[model samples]
Target: MSQFNLTINQKKYDVDVDPQMPLLWVIRDIIGLTGTKYGCGIAQCGACTIHFDGKAMRSCVLPISNVGDAKITTIEGLSDDGSHPTQVAWKEMDVPQCGYCQAGQIMAAVDLINKKPNPSDEDIHRGMTNVCRCGTYNRIKSAIKLAAEGGKS
Candidate 1:
């Protein structure tokens, strides 16, 4: 077991784990942050998405050793009271159905908005590849637009 120091949501965590362990398990099992879900163990599913130094990353396939000193932001760390623009827009747009993938969706949305600021529909379509089983794509798109608009909608 190797020791890793992770900066998550502005908090610091020191954990001793296998170097090859995926960050998903370390965050969910070791650190007890369940907001980042485990959907497909592979990186294809966005359920394990998190902000790795402000970029959206799939934690399920990211080994702890690869994390290094990057800043990690999970859904729980996005905002203390769920007041982030994306979160607010998500609530306003009523974006989740089964809600299993919402956290990753929100994280991805935040990254999209941060990168594009005012993303076009095409940009959104291209950027958000996260799978949603409940077919909430329309709502998710609308919420992304609202968030890009600074939660005006």
Candidate 2:
């Protein structure tokens, strides 16, 4: 086991684990942060999405050794009270259905908006590849739009 120092949600964590262990397990099991879910174990699914130094990353396939000193941000770190624009828009648009994928969705949405402050529908469609089993794509789109507009809608 190797020691890793991770800075998540502005908090520092020192953990001793296998270098090949996926960040998803470290976050959920070791660190006890369950907001980032485990989906397809592989990186294809976005359920394990998190912010890796302000960019969206799939945690399930990312080994702890690959994390290095980059700052990580999970859903729990996005906002203390769920006041983030994307989060607010999510609630206003009632985006989630099963809600299993919402955290990853929101994280991806935040990254999208950060890159394109006013993202076009095409941009959203292209940027948000996160899978939603409940088929809430329309609502997710609406929420993204609202968030792009600073949650005005």
Candidate 3:
């Protein structure tokens, strides 16, 4: 085990873990932040998504050693009261069905908007590849649009 300093959600955490351990375990098990889920241990599924240095990253495949000094942001960090534009838009649009993938979806959505403030429909389709088993793609798109509009919904 090695000691590593992680800045997550604007808070600093010092943890002792194997450098090769996946970030998802470090966040969910060691840090006790469960919002970042475990879907596929690989990067194929977006359920383990988080923002690393303001970029969307799949935590499930990201090793602690690879994290380096980047600041991490999970869904919990997006807003304290769930009032972020994405969160608000999601609620307004009722975008979750099973809700298992919503956190990753939201993280990806926020990143998408950050990259393209006025994202076109193609932009949304290209940027958001997070899988939602509940088939909430329509609602997710609507929420993303609403969020891009500054939560006007």
TM-score of each: 0.97, 0.97, 0.97
lDDT of each: 0.94, 0.94, 0.92
- Stretches of candidate 3 off by over 4 Å are 151-153
- Candidate 1 local Cα displacement, residue 125, angstroms: 0.4
lDDT of 1 by residue, 113-141 (tens): 88898899999999999999999999999
Candidate 2 pairs with clashing backbones: none
lDDT for model 2, please: 0.94
After superposition, the stretches of candidate 1 with alpha carbons farther than 4 Å from their true spots are 151-153
How many clashes in each structure? 0, 0, 0
Candidate achieving higher lDDT, 2 or 3: 2
Q: Residues 30-76, candidate 2, lDDT per residue (tens digit)?
A: 99999999999988879999999999999999999999999999999
Residue-pair clashes, model 1: 0
Query: What C-alpha lDDT does candidate 3 achieve relative to the native structure?
Result: 0.92
Model 1 vs truth, CA RMSD: 1.6
